[model samples]
Target: MENFVLILLAIVIGYIINRLNIFSKDAPTILNQFAIYISLPAMILLQIPKLSFSIDMIIPIIVAWIVMFISAILILVLSKFFSFSKEITGSLMLVSILTNSSFLGIPIINAYMGESAMPYVLVYDQLGTFIALATYGTFIASYYSNKNKITFKIMTLKVLTFPPFLSLIVALFLIGVEFNPVITKVLSSFASTIVPVALVAVGLQLQLRLPREEIKPFSVALIVKLIIAPLIAFIICKIFAWDNQASIVSIMEAGMAPMITAGAIASMAGLAPRLSTAIVGYGIIISFITTGFLFKIIS
Candidate 1:
């Protein structure tokens, strides 16, 4: 609970900084790039090598893919009723499919379930959500942009060149090798900045004053993300009879708010920037309440 409170406090601090105009508008972008390229990759390199391989490790990835495809299909069917613009639809796909599984999910699991849950959290983020973001996410962003043509080569290159993904590859190779304690400590020190930096960056970028027109689509997207997605994960766990602790963590991670990077992806792709930002900002606020309720129920 202290950990979760710290996460929220970091966000609040960032928000206050933004409100006070303490930094330029570009501060969030710079912070995001730093987290993605430096802190996040270091964190992955430190954690992934320590993880023992297991078939169970793949379940979280499978759950993520299931949610992504299911959300896509649902969005396609509901598009008719909503009469959403191409940009709004694209933003919806990004938010609903991807999750804040790493930044928010890790802390929540660590607080509630302890170090035992770390390996599963790492798998869900690195193998599952990360891959989905690099591949399917890129495809959706490009497809919706309509301005830039997406090629198979481009998509493959995006995945291969992503810093964290590259770090994951390196970590896998070093899995069984022992590292000097000093080196490991150094890496861990750099890695430790990820969560707070990420949350602060999210807060800096967040805009709570949403446009009236976007509320309906945003609400539906959150429903798929925070509600329906986890319900599906719970059902999957029951059917597969996964380990109880892993299943609970998986469900809770699935229930996380929209991905922080989703808005950046949408904006870069020339999709609905306003809608994407609105979803991310509002989603994070609401998730505080929803995830707390979920933790209570599952506990």
Candidate 2:
């Protein structure tokens, strides 16, 4: 309960800072980069080496993939009835298929389940959502834009070259190795900044007000992300009889907001940038309520 309060406080502080214009508009981007390139990798390095590898570890990744595939199929079928344009369809695909698993999921899991859950969260984000974004996400972007053709080489390169993904590889390699005390301490220091900084970055980027026309599309995307996706995860868990903390965490992660990076990708692909941004923004707000509800039910 205390951790939940702290999470809210950090978000409020960040929102206050943004409302006051205490930081430049670029502040959120810089903070996000710092979390991605520096703090997040540091956290991964510190945590991943300690996790025992198991078949269960891969469940989160599978759950993520299942959610993405299901979402895609549903959207395609729904488009037949809804008369959505190519751009709107593309934007919905990006928003519903990907999630803010890293920035938002990490903190929420940490707050509720603590650092012991970090390994599963990392697996869900890196192996699961990140891989989907690189491969499936790029394909959707390319398909909508009709610009650059996506290839396996391009998708593989994106995943392989990501800093945190590389860190995961290095961490796995060092699983049985010992690190010097000083080096471990330094990594710990950097890792410690991840949650607070990430939450603040989230607050800075969050946008609540949207044009009325956008509300319908944004709500549709949010229902898939915050409601349907998690429900799918829950059913998958039940069907597999995977009753464990990691499985629960994966469900919660599925309910996270639309991926912020996915929004940027959508815009660059000439999809509906305004709608994408609004989905990301409003989705973050709704996620707080949905995540809290999930946590209560799970607990």
Candidate 3:
């Protein structure tokens, strides 16, 4: 409960900051850069080195991917009803299929399912979720933007420099090294900032206006995110008969709001920003009610 409440509080504070115009949009770029360069690397050092993978992790991973893939396919089916360009349709489908299972997923699981779930969650973030985002996400965004043409140089540069990817490599290195006090201190302090800065960064980037006409599209997107996504996770858990703890963690991570990174990618890809923002905001807001009741039920 402590973890869940803290994350919610941070998100609430972010919304407050956004409404108040605490900083211009320009300020968060630095924070985003800091998170990418400093906080993210620190987090990778702390979590990755300490991680130990397992075959059991594979079950949740496959479940997660299956759920996402199914949802993406569903979005494409629904897109036929709309008149959106292929780029917009692809971006919308991308966001619909993906969830924010990492930056925001950790604290929620830690609060409800306990720290035991972290390894499952971490591996999901690393290999399962991140890989999808890099390949599928980039493909959708770039394809929509008419930039899908890839040279070896572009692909190599993107994969190598991605912050999370870099962190994953560093973490693998940490697996064999002796833990040291100096590294711990630096990583601990810097990593501590990820949650707060990230939420506020969400706030900083948010613009509240959207076309009321697109409310139809927006609601459809949110329903997929908050309802369909979590339901699939729970159903997968039940089908596979995931044990109690893993089941709860699966639901929590799977229900997570849309990826914030999706917003950046969508904008860069020239997708509908209003639709993306609406999806992200609605998912976070509803998560409190839905996730709150959910944990109580599981408990």
Candidate 4:
């Protein structure tokens, strides 16, 4: 409950700050840069090294990948059907496919399923959503933000040079090697900033009154992210006969709000900033009710 309240409070504070003109228009961008550059890497270093992969992790990991891949393809086709611009298409790609599987997923899953289910949540998060944010998120930001024709070389370079991605690579190698307490503490302090910072960034740009043109895309994004994504995960679980806690966690994670980081990345890339922030802002609020109903149905 406290976690949920903290997220909402941070968003409210950001919105209030925006109204007060306390910061320049570049405030959201600066906060996002902090999240992507400093906090995200610190989180990766702090958490990834501690993960020990196991056979049990395969189901949630595979389920997460499948949901994202299918969702991405669907969003592309729908964007073309609706005649969305390259920027809108790119924004939808990031905000729809990547989910708030960690920030929102952790507490919500823990509340519904208990501590034993947490490992599955971590598996789906670190191995699933986190990797997508670093790779797919970076790719979309580069591909859409660039005006010139992009090549595989440039995309690869962008992903490689992305700070969080670089940290992920280093963290993977450091697995099984314990860090000194001082180093761990430092990393934790920085890592803790990711959620609040990202949420505040989202709030800073949140738009309540939308132009008629944006309504369709916003509605489409929410339906895809909060509804169809989880439905797909549920069907996959049923097909595989995964009648277990891991499957439950994976399905719920799929239904989470648009990733705070993904929306920040989309806005940072100038991919319809207002629409991206609105999708994230409204999505998180709506997810509270949707996720509870989802838990009841699945359980």
Candidate 5:
């Protein structure tokens, strides 16, 4: 509850700062760079080393990918049906296919399902969403934004060179090793900055009023992300008879809003920048109600 409140407060503060024009136009870019290059890597180094992979953990990961894959296909079909341009289609793919499974998922799930569900949340984020962000996300950004033909080698190189992905690789090898107390504390401090820094960055870019052309894409993104995606997860859980805590957490994660970083990537790639920000901003606000409704249905 406290963490959820903090997210809202940080967003409000960022919105206020933007409205006052207290920061330069490049402020959000600087914050996002700090998050991607510094805080996100620190977080991976800090958390990934603590994870112990097991067969039991595969459920959430599998479900997360399934949801993303199905949703991505749906987005493609919808894009064709609506005759969306390449930029709008790319923006929808970034925001809707990826989910805010960590920053929002961890805290929100903790508040709803209690601390016992943390492991599943972490699994869904790191093994599923995080890896997808580094790999599939890089692919989306490169493939959609560029007019030139992108090759598999270029995609692999980008994933390998991504800061957080490199950190994740290093962190995996250090799983059994212990870190120095002082170093751990330093990493922890940096890791903690991702949430507020990211939310504030999102708020800084947020615009409530949408241009007329963006309404349909924005609406489609939110519906796919917050409602349709999770509903798919829930139905799969029933199909598999996964009536467990892990399944519950996975369902909630599937219901989360657009990934803030995904939106950042879309905007950075010049893929319908304003529309991307609007979906990410409003998606978070609306997901609160939608997630609550989902919890009642699934739980």
Candidate 6:
């Protein structure tokens, strides 16, 4: 109930921001920059360094890999069935597979599952979703854009250099190191702001529009992402692949909706703005329904 209320509040606040123009046109750029360089790094640092490694990352990775892989396959099939442009197909693939595992992901998990949920979500996103986005997603986006060729080597470098990715790496190295009281306090304060800011950003970013061609692409993404993904995660859990918290965690991650970052990237790459916008908006609306459903079932 609290989570739902918070989401509602976020939506109202976001709508207000959109109406008042306080964000101006530049807010998205500034927010993305802040999230990447500041908030994301702070949150990653707080989580990564404190843990022993888990073999369980394998299942979640497999689950995530399967989700992304299936997304591509589905898009290819969608191409056959639906006749979207290459750019639109690329946009759909990016949005469909790359769940919003960062901004909105952490908070939603934290709220329903607990702060302990952070580790599972981060490792899954860092090792799986984010990595896939950097390599596979980038390749598709680049290929469709066809401006310049980007090699795997350059792409790997770019991935590693991203602030959150770098922070995750550093945190791994710092594992077992103890933090002083003052340092812990500072980090706690820094870590606390990620969720609220993200929800606000989500609200500010929301838009509704008529879907071209009946928005069939969104309906497909909505079903696959919000429904099918969680079902697969549940099967993995029930099969004894992940137990209890880990199962819940994987389901949480899998249940995530489209990453708005995908939309931003699609727009930046100059391919299929219309499709990207639909995926972002429609994905969120449907995600609210599915995430709540997953939370209830998992609980």
Better of 1 and 6 by lDDT: 1
lDDT of 5: 0.85
Q: RMSD to native for every prediction? A: 1.7, 1.7, 2.7, 3.6, 2.8, 2.0
lDDT of 1 by residue, 1-299 (tens): 68888888889988999999998999988888888898878877777777676766678777777767787788776765889888888888898779999778877777788867776777788778888888888889878887777788987898899888888889888876778999889888878888788788877877887889888898888999889888888788778888566677788888999998877898788778888888888999998888888878776
Taking the tens digit of each residue's C-alpha lDDT, what string does model 5 give over 25-61?
9988898789878987887787667657665568899
Alpha-carbon RMSD, candidate 6: 2.0
Model 5: CA > 4 A from native: 113-119, 141-148, 176-180, 268-270
Candidate that would win on lDDT: 2
Task: Provide the lDDT at 119 for model 5.
Answer: 59
lDDT of 5 at 75: 100
lDDT of 4 by residue, 16-59 (tens): 99999998999988988998789878877776676576645588
For model 1, state the Cα shift of residue 88 in Å.
1.7
Residues 72-109, candidate 6: write the lDDT tens digits. 78777976788877777777777777888877788778
Q: Give the deviation of candidate 2 from the true structure as CA RMSD.
A: 1.7
In model 3, residue pairs whose N, Cα or C atoms come closer than 3 Å (at least 3 residues apart or on different chains), thus clashing, are none
Q: Which residue pairs in model 6 clash with each other? A: none
In terms of TM-score, how similar is model 2 to the real structure? 0.94
Candidate 3's C-alpha runs over 4 A off are 1-5, 81-88, 147-153, 176-178, 244-247, 297-299
Task: Report the lDDT tens digits of candidate 3 across residue range 64-163.
Answer: 7887887887777777777666755866776676777766777666676765676567667766677777777777777777855845566567778788
Provide the lowest-lDDT 10-residue window in model 1. 48-57
Question: If both were scored by TM-score, which would come out higher, candidate 1 or candidate 3?
Answer: 1
Worst 10 residues of 4 by lDDT: 147-156
Tell me the lDDT of model 5 at 181: 100
Over 4 Å off in model 4, which ranges? 76-91, 102-146, 243-246, 260-277
